[model samples]
Target: MKQVTEKFRFGIDIGGTGIKAGVVSTENQILGQAYVPTGAERSWQEVVPDIVHAAEEALKDAGEFMENCISVGIGCPGTIDAQTGTVVYSNNLNWQNVPLAQELHRTFTQPVFISNDANCAALGEVCAGAAKGFQNVFMLTLGTGVGSGIIINGRIFEGGGPGGAEFGHTLLVEDGELCTCGRRGCLESYASATALIRQAKRTAKQAPNSLLCTLCKGDLSRMDGRIPFQAARQGDEAGQRVIREYIKHLAAGIANAVNIFRPQAVLLSGGISKEGTYLTDPLTALVAEEVFGKKNSFLPQIRAAELGNTAGMIGAANLSQ
Candidate 1:
């Protein structure tokens, strides 16, 4: 006769480029992890199988089989009908009406939960990261595009529907840069990491004497956002000018959020967030300068997200509960 092993939860993060999964415990520790390319190029058809493989590997890494698992949760980009576990749409994977929850349940016979990736990260931060002690957290991911998630009272506070907090779409300017959503001057257009790179390239082309010209090796499209930040650290004049405007737009967006939610903490995550203190410290200074108050009364204490890339998976696992 053999004794039963304790059950464990599984969390999965699905992105445009890859899939991340982890085995989590009741205490929120990630006991194991697995990764694989999303294979989105193969069409949404083959992508489903890729998800199953990733999940199986994570379970194997934990030395636990599916039968011993308690529940599973997935965090994905797009609108989700959380109650029905349906993915309304996803631009990265080009999936629509994806019955993600039912597919996982049929394959693994485990309870399944589905949520937007941003919401998952907000949940993860509340449960395990910078916002661990705070009752309210607002997370902004400034990557190829801007993604936002808000947590209130320890839950993903989608006011009514999935459209609850599309903060990135808030109009920053009218008729600005063209956006994939067919909008102009969306927050994502002016402040996303990708947007910064595009702006940097345009600047470098005009300011050929700047360091960006050398860093890009004359291939303007190759410029990285870090180049300008690095040059700024060196006191380069062009870098300073470029960064100043970047910070202005970013600060404006954040300041507006503060006026709305008055969250306990604002966590920033994603590639550009690595600018670290360079961005955080100055951002704090700038937001304070523009936030319409004297004592930092209107702005939240901004902090970098502690969970990093794993936030998505950690949040996914939490959704199962």
Candidate 2:
């Protein structure tokens, strides 16, 4: 393995709302942290400089000169060509084949690496989190939609160009709810926080006398996870239905992952995952039932991600090795 300290690596995580950059040590400790709004309205040309500025700020915060840095890595949300360091497409950024790595190299005068956000999260897991001691792991991020990363033998296996792991898009039902990826019956159609919210809204609309309806103030559009979860705790049948179905869909996805990768662990992140055992415990039981793998202790253990929002950048920095 390349020595992490032989050269400091800079990591930049460009999210839908903000950009986080930092100087990270080989041991996976963040030496410095800095942030800036993503400013979605700005074009990539305008965005590149903002990323550069964030990197510069991180270097300064770490009391390190630019010359000491080995490489700069970016974990971007998009379909990326990791081999070429190009953004093939991004739903949120609306960027296409933006040569972010090339642009960063031109601006910061250092080698730059870029990868899909899900892959970056997996890298973060292997580098510093639950998978640190293991070379193979799966990271499932339960956010507005589901995202996944597969780390095999300490490296991300990108299928062809920019694809890492897209568990969310896998079809679970025939002609289910439409997905942002333009697909129907995607796992995300039933399991994502957005999906949960949609379920809640429909239930709220029908159960006008329910507490969820009161929480949403009779507005279906305003119904969301918080209200549903609250209603579930308050023993509302509609909330219970939403949560149970969401868990089932999520479990099905995890079980599929287990059968495919046989990873050392399955890590979860994002706000929805914060539901904790309410999700993990049952998901584990479902995996035991659904996964085709041997009923042995070798089954992947599911856990929550420790790095939170910064996991992407942390994983990106470790890519320098």
Clashes of each: 0, 0
Per-residue lDDT of candidate 2, residues 87-144 (tens digit): 9888888888798888877877777888888889889978887677878888877778
lDDT (tens digit, per residue) of candidate 1 on 212-297: 66777888877888988887788877777778878888888888887787788888888778888888898888888776574547
- Computed on alpha carbons, the lDDT of every model, listed in order, comes to 0.82, 0.82
TM-score of each: 0.92, 0.93
Which residue pairs does candidate 1 place in steric collision? none
- Misplaced by over 4 Å in model 1 are 1-5, 43-45, 65-68, 292-298
Tell me the lDDT of model 2 at 244.
Answer: 80
Location of the lowest summed lDDT over 10 successive residues in candidate 1: 1-10
Task: Report residue 94 deviation for candidate 1 (angstroms).
Answer: 0.9
What is the C-alpha local distance difference test score of candidate 1?
Answer: 0.82
TM-score of 1: 0.92
